[model samples]
Target: MKENRSREMYEEIKNITKTFQPRLGVIKDEKGNILTESKQIVDRWKRYCEKMYSSDSTADQQEKLEETREDKEINLLPLRSEIEWAIGSLKDGKSPGCDDI
Candidate 1:
């Protein structure tokens, strides 16, 4: 039992210490130049994300959205009977979904 445990521990340690070399395909910059250095690749990705998601609205737009929200009707929750019907409709003996239901 001790020998088996030691062998398992050795295998675990070997797996942990193994260098993980991920095969990242060639990543190119916006100018179509391939980036090789780690810093250059990271910076190119940062610039891309910034350009892609920089269109967030300003604070004034947020206030306008809040003001408009009050005009919309409030949504009601489903009745207990309706919820029970939905749950009862699911097939039996299958794995539960990510929600565990």
Candidate 2:
């Protein structure tokens, strides 16, 4: 259990230490499961920085960029129903039951 916790911590720290240009894609876990792949999230950060530093970029361009980014994000992948259902159940204070289907 300690080893597992240590590995998880290391993974989290490794993620925190990276500095890179934002690319649109999913980040995966050790088991190749996606942790986050929200293009909207990445777009928001870029837009914020641009708004602060790149004063020449107009609002119309930003709005168009947002629309393109959103379309990419929506089409990149879809979540499994089981995962969504379980998340909803936990959020609603209900138990997630196992499905044999």
Output the lDDT of residue 8, model 1.
88
- Pairs that collide in candidate 1 are none
In model 2, the clashing pairs are none
Best by TM-score: 1
Top lDDT: which candidate number?
A: 1
Per-residue CA lDDT of candidate 1, range 13-38, in tens? 99999998898756999889998988
- The worst-scoring run of ten residues by lDDT in candidate 1 lies at 51-60
User: How do the residues 9-67 of candidate 2 rate in per-residue lDDT, one tens digit apiece?
Assistant: 88888899978878646555445555564875565557667676664667667888999
Clashes of 2: 0
Evaluated at residue 79, the lDDT of candidate 1 is 92
**Model 2 worst lDDT run, 10 consecutive residues:** 26-35
Measured over all alpha carbons after superposition, the RMSD of each candidate to the real structure, in angstroms, is 9.5, 18.1
